[model samples]
Target: MHQPTVQDFQSLKRILRYVKGTKHHGLPIIPGDSQLCTYTDADWASDTSDRKSITGHFTFMGPNLISWFIKEQVTVAKSSTEAEYRALSAATSETIWLRHLSAKLRLEQNIPTTIYCDNISAIAIAKNPVFHGRTKHIEID
Candidate 1:
C-alpha cells in the first residue's frame, strides 16, 4: 500500500470528525419492509482528471437507506451512454452483493427490485436481452 501523505491523513481526520459530529445523519434500516430497491446515477465527464465521472448509488429497504456508495469511474467514456452504463453496472454489482447479504440475514428482498436510471438509452440497453448492432461495443454482463 502507498504511504499516507500529510494531506491524506488530514482528510481522513476531517472525515472522522464529520462522522463523529453527525452521528444521526444516517437513516436506520428496518428489515420487514422488504420492498428493497436501489438507484444509481452518475454525471458523465464531470471530472477533468482522466475525464472520469462520479457515480452515486443508494439501496433502500422501504424508505430507509440500507446501503449507499459514491465512486469515480475508472475508464473515460467516449459517450454519455457508455458512462451511464458503466456507473449503473457498478452499482448493480454492489446491489447484487447487498441482496445476497440481506438474504443471509433473513431480511431477504421479497419483491423484484428495480434499479432506476434517468437515462432511457441505458435502461433500454439493460433491459434488452439481445444486443443490437449499435450496442455491440458495450460489454454489459
Candidate 2:
C-alpha cells in the first residue's frame, strides 16, 4: 500500500464496480427441514507454482447455504484423493461447529449430518477404519 501502482488503482476500481453492480443481490434463507449437509471437492495441484490443491465446500442447513469456503491447502497432496480427503476434513470440521451452534440455539439435529464427496477413492478412504500405507503419510490431528 505504501507504493500504490496503476494496476492497484485499476483493481480497486474493478472491485468497486462489481460491488455497486451486485448491491441489490441477497442470500435468501428459506425455512425448511433441519437436515445438515455439505458438499466438498478439491482441484488437485491446481496451482502450478506451488503444486498446492484448491479446496472448496458448501455447507447447508436444509435447502439454505449456511457456510462455504474456497482456500488453498496448507500442505501439498500427492493425489486427487488426498486433496479431496483434505477438503472433506475441513468441511467436516465446519459441519461439527455448525451442529454445536444449532444445538445451543435450541435446534438440535436429530439425524446425522451428511457429507457428499465426488471422489470415490476419498470416500472409500474415509469409510475405511484402518489407515493403510497409502494414507499413512497424512497427519492425524
For all candidates, the clash counts are 0, 0
Query: TM-score of every model?
Result: 0.74, 0.79
Candidate 2: RMSD over Cα atoms?
Answer: 8.8
lDDT of 1 by residue, 1-141 (tens): 158799999999999999889888775545556766888888898998678878888888787887888888777777787777877888789888888888878886777788888888888778774744576566753
Question: What's the C-alpha lDDT at position 10 in model 1?
Answer: 93
Worst 10 residues of 1 by lDDT: 132-141
The TM-score, computed over Cα atoms with residue i paired to residue i, of candidate 2 is 0.79
The number of the candidate with the highest TM-score is 2
Candidate 2 lDDT over residue span 8-102, tens digit each: 99999999999788877867768898888999999999999999999999988889988999999999999998899899889999999999999
Which pairs clash in model 2?
A: none
- Output the lDDT of residue 109, model 2: 94
